[model samples]
Target: MQTEVIIVGGSFAGLSAALMLARARRDVLVIDAGKPRNRFASHSHGVLGMDGIAGSDLLKTARQQLLDYPSVRWLSGEAVEAAVGADGVQVSLADGTLATARKLLLATGISDQLPDIPGLAERWGSTVLHCPYCHGYEVGGGAIGVLGGVEGAAAKAALLADWGTITFFSQGLPITDDEAASLQQRGVQIETTPVVAVQGEQPQWLELVLADGRHSAQRALFAPALQAMATPLVEQLGCRLVDSPLGVLIDVDAQKQTSVPGVYAAGDASVIGNITLASAEGVRAGVGIHHALVAEDSRPRPTAG
Candidate 1:
């Protein structure tokens, strides 16, 4: 099928973009793989008017809002490949379907790679988190532990001190004398033992069992160096990538347009992974696409002389 715009992901970013285009009377289609980065997170914070709302619920509301527009369509499958050619942007689905669109929006979010500690993955999003602003207030004023052995761990631990009493787990990561003194001055306890496992009941408490047969109880564990998994669909389309302190992200212009013309990206794929920011970028991309379409349609035609 063909559409004026095709959004690759249907979460916050893609849906927001689609809503804008659909409101402008454009035929938009959104294809989602059903794997939002925050799927494991029960509730999402920091989004105005939707604070503490369940992450899945937010997507459901967005989907329902899109259903109100007849010009918009959704596909419940993965977009395996995408290419731009004379016909336009062609996207192939895993279910043997092909979709073409004049403009394409890639909002496919990134995947976070956690540490190799036992029981950590299972408790991710609930007890173990990355963003202090998102989950900090909920677990605030308690004993929080920062897992070491990764870059920027010390700084993160120091920053988190305001939220609670911080315990920096070195986890076999070397700590210099000066660094130790600074952390000690800030009253952040430094544990040099390795963390063998992370076991806990989420929203209540967590225990980090150390290799020395000791365990530390904390309200939450923060990991700063979680790696982000690249999106194959975006790579297949040959989009330019930029390496930031967060991770490798899709390069975009002020209007969220990527390196390739007629192709745009937003959300966690282009910027830091946050629902509010992603939704805002999606709206910008939508407006940019609308203006581009209007300009193209209104271009002057050569007179027959």
Candidate 2:
């Protein structure tokens, strides 16, 4: 199928882009795999008008709104591969469907690679959380544990200081004397032992079982070692990527256009992972695409030789 724009990933970022382009009268097709990174979180916070809304329900509402714009089409499928040429960009799906478009937008958010601690995965998004701005307020006002030895771990613990009592589990991560002093001043307890397990459930609370046979009770645990899952599509399209403290992310300009001319990216794939941030980037990308298309069409034609 041919379209003016093809958006891969129909969650927040993708839907936001579609809303802008469709309202501008552009034919856009959104291909979604149906699994959003935030699907595990029952309700999303920090989103201005959408606070306390379930992640799934928010997407459902966005998709329903798109029904008012016939120019936008939604496809439930995974984008397996993508290629860009002088003519346009072409995307392939796992179902063998081929979609071609003048411009391509990738809102495919990165996947988080959680540490292999027993019981951690099961409690993710509930008792276990990430992003102080997103989950901090909800899990605040109690004893909280920040896991990981990375550079960002201490910073996370420091940020959560005001929310509640924080315990910084170094997890075999060597902490310098200064880092320890800083955390101590902030009322954060430093635990050098690694976490062997994360036990218990939410509402009832949880326990951070350590290797030293000491279990620490916490209202919630924060982990800071999120990594982006590798995707070959970006490489195939020749988009440049930059390694960040969080993980490798697609390098894009202020307008959210990637290194490739006709390719754009938004959401967790490009910047800090947040629902509100992702949606804003999507709007910028949509406007950028529209401006580029109009400029290309309005360019003066070359005179015949």
Candidate 3:
């Protein structure tokens, strides 16, 4: 299929970009794998006007609204490969379907790699979390725990203290003296014992089991999750990759255009994970793509010689 713009991954970022292009009467094809990074979260917070809404529900509504435009089309599948050529950009789906467009926007999002602790994965997005800003308020000023091993764990623990009493578990990782002092200054308690397992009821109470046969109860555990690109499409297209504090992300400009010409990236794939930031990046990419397309279409053609 051929379209003006092809958006891979139709989650918040892709959908937001599609809406903008659809309104501009541009033909847009969005390929989605139907698995969003936040699908595990029962509710999405910090988004204006839609605060505390279920992440899935917000996506469903947005998908419906975007599809209402005649120029917009949604494909439920995975884009396994992508390439850019003089003609345009082409994306191949896992089912062998090929989509070509004048420009490509990668909103493929990211995947969170949780620590190898028992019971952690199952309770993720509920009792275990990554972003304090997104899920902190609901902690209700209760006991909070931070599992170590990720970069800047002490700083994270200090910041999380605003929400409640914080317990920073070192998980056997070394903490710098400065970091330890800073954590102490912020009234954050440091626990050196490694967290062997997490136990809890779904979406409510949680208990951390230590390796030394100790258990600590808490309302929620904040563990920094290592992030990785959800798809290899970014590398396939030769887009420049950059390292962020969280993980590797596709390098993009202020307008969300990737290093590769005619290719752009937005959302968690390009920037830090946040619903509002993802949507905003999508809007910027949409406008950037539209302007690029217009400039290309308006170029003067050479006269026959």
lDDT by candidate, in order shown: 0.87, 0.88, 0.92
> Which one wins by lDDT: 1 or 2?
2
- Among all candidates shown, the one with the greatest lDDT: 3
Off by over 4 Å in 3: none
Q: Write the per-residue lDDT of candidate 2 for residues 1-305, one digit (tens) a residue.
A: 99999999898898999999999999999999998989988899988987889999999989999968989888998899999988999999999999999999999988888888889888989889887788889885889899976777887788789888999999898887778788989999988889999989575799999998999999999986566844568878889999889888999998889999999999889988689889998999999899888988899999998
The lDDT of model 1 is 0.87
1 or 2, which is superior by TM-score?
A: 2
Clashes (backbone N, CA, C under 3 Å), per candidate, total 0, 0, 0
Q: What TM-score does model 2 achieve against the real structure?
A: 0.95
Which pairs clash inside model 1? none
Candidate 1 segments whose C-alpha is farther than 4 A from its true place: 174-182, 225-230, 302-305
Evaluation by lDDT, superior candidate among 1 and 3: 3
Greater-TM-score candidate between 1 and 3: 3
